[model samples]
Target chain A: MTSWLPTLQTATPEDGYDLAVKLARVAVKATQPDAAVRDRLRPEYAEDADALIAVSHVVATHFATVAAANNYWRNRT
Target chain B: MTSWLPTLQTATPEDGYDLAVKLARVAVKATQPDAAVRDRLRPEYAEDADALIAVSHVVATHFATVAAANNYWRNRT
Candidate 1:
């Protein structure tokens, strides 16, 4: 498998945000390689609002990390 | 802001997975527009294992939906 953690680079904050989401998803795939199991368990949390909010929270954390890693993508020429 | 629910299309399963992640992020942004507020709350869920797991659960749910929408990106001759 490819490296789970790749070098962070983005041209814009939106791209950084997108990369953050990718990181979150990559972390998930790394933890759970079984797609069938993940699919089977989806319904348990799919409709739960709190669970969904947790998703956003994790993504936000990732976005923050990615933003900081790129220095908020500042000073771009 | 762009449409949160953009038309989903992907050339491969990986891209589809990326789109699923995007969808998850868009959902979050749509629900919460305040970046500072989200950043403030990030630490609460960032270190919580259960909260992190919930992120995967939600992503899987979104992946399942995207996979179905794209017919699993199968039979691409």
Candidate 2:
């Protein structure tokens, strides 16, 4: 039971996508206990899947780039 | 990233609810390994939230009724 549960209980199908995205963000927190990931979802709370997916892609890409940079540093050293 | 990811990637916002519902079912399976709950979601896979909420209400009502019945039987004995 979340703060959004009441709204979800009352939302129309047109609004269901937004509600579902909110639930999905909550579900991600509920599933993945990673604080960093949780932080990523917070500001994006009102965002739809397109926005969330785009942010996720950015986060993942940044992480991959960082990892690649570290690997490059290790190889150089 | 399950079998539905490909479809989700391509689905319009109109289809996102159904897709999100599908993902929610998979997520419940992924999250809750309870076979009985899993079974409940299975038959209702294609159902929308309205349909799911209805079935869930029915199941909960039936469960509560059975529990009440058992309590009554015990009290009588």
Candidate 3:
């Protein structure tokens, strides 16, 4: 979308879900912040860091679960 | 992926992300629980229902953020 946020790669749904998790993690990296993105998300983020932090975990777990499911199926074949 | 879980439609990354949110909510539907999934996710979910409920919101919001971006580009064209 906008050039500000880190982009999630999307080769396929399965792969994209996995990538979104990674992108979110990168966005929250302690060492570096995308200035434009920080400005863009500032309002809600300043108000609710807890909620934003919580999702970084949830979406990561959700994608992992989906990835694990794919692995489970691939092994069956 | 499995028949037991709600399937996400995957055409592209942008669209798939949106669909993932819908699938998650469907999986958590109050009326019908996916028996197989409930069993699979029992350990974590049984321990904490709050986080799972919260991701249902995050992923949805994340998808909407992306969709708005796509529209932002489309409108400019």
Candidate 4:
């Protein structure tokens, strides 16, 4: 599938970067047990569900990857 | 301090982004407990240890945010 985060035509690199961060923030709010915060982040994905979901998956995997890498080196040197 | 990944002067948006993914991959390889792969990723962190470390932290936190956000809404709606 096409890249949802990087390929948006009208989005500047800065915009895309900011959006990535926004999506990242929303992702964290997603795992919370609270309904209100979840409600707040809903609009981001509501109109473009598929793209948002795809972005979410990429963002999640990316996070897991980097976190593990940083921790690995942290212990070694 | 300045942003690590985004602020790299020579980096294109695509390059900065690809580097982000590379960092993530390196992060995962880091947790493998395998010496060889860890050796491989060390060069990435070697010269600009401060910037690479900064990028790692941001990537980690961003990933955490998005993953949690995705999961929260996944269960609810």
Q: Give the CAPRI rating of model 4.
A: incorrect
- In candidate 4, how many Å is residue B47 off? 35
Q: Which candidate wins on TM-score?
A: 1
Question: After best superposition, candidate 3 residue A27: deviation in angstroms?
Answer: 2.6
lDDT, model 4, position B13:
28
Candidate 2 Cα misplacement greater than 4 A, ranges:
A1-77, B40-77
**Which regions in candidate 3 have their CA more than 4 angstroms from the true location?**
A1-9, A32-53, A56-77, B1-7, B10-53, B62-77
CA shift of A47, model 2, Å: 31
Q: Tell me the lDDT of model 3 at A64.
A: 45
Candidate 4, B1-77: lDDT as tens digits: 67544432221223334344455555566578797876776555433323333343455454444333333122321
Q: Higher-TM-score candidate among 1 and 4? A: 1
- Ordering by lDDT: 1, 3, 4, 2
Clashes of each: 0, 0, 0, 10
Candidate 1: Cα lDDT at A77: 75
- RMSD per model, one decimal: 16.8, 22.7, 13.9, 19.0
Off by over 4 Å in 1: A1-77, B1-5
Report, to 2 decimal places, the DockQ of model 3: 0.05
Candidate 1's TM-score: 0.48
Model 3: clashing residue pairs? none
Best by DockQ: 1
Clashing pairs in 4: A27-B65, A27-B66, A27-B68, A27-B69, A28-B65, A28-B69, A30-B69, A30-B72, A31-B68, A69-B27
Supply the TM-score for candidate 2.
Answer: 0.24
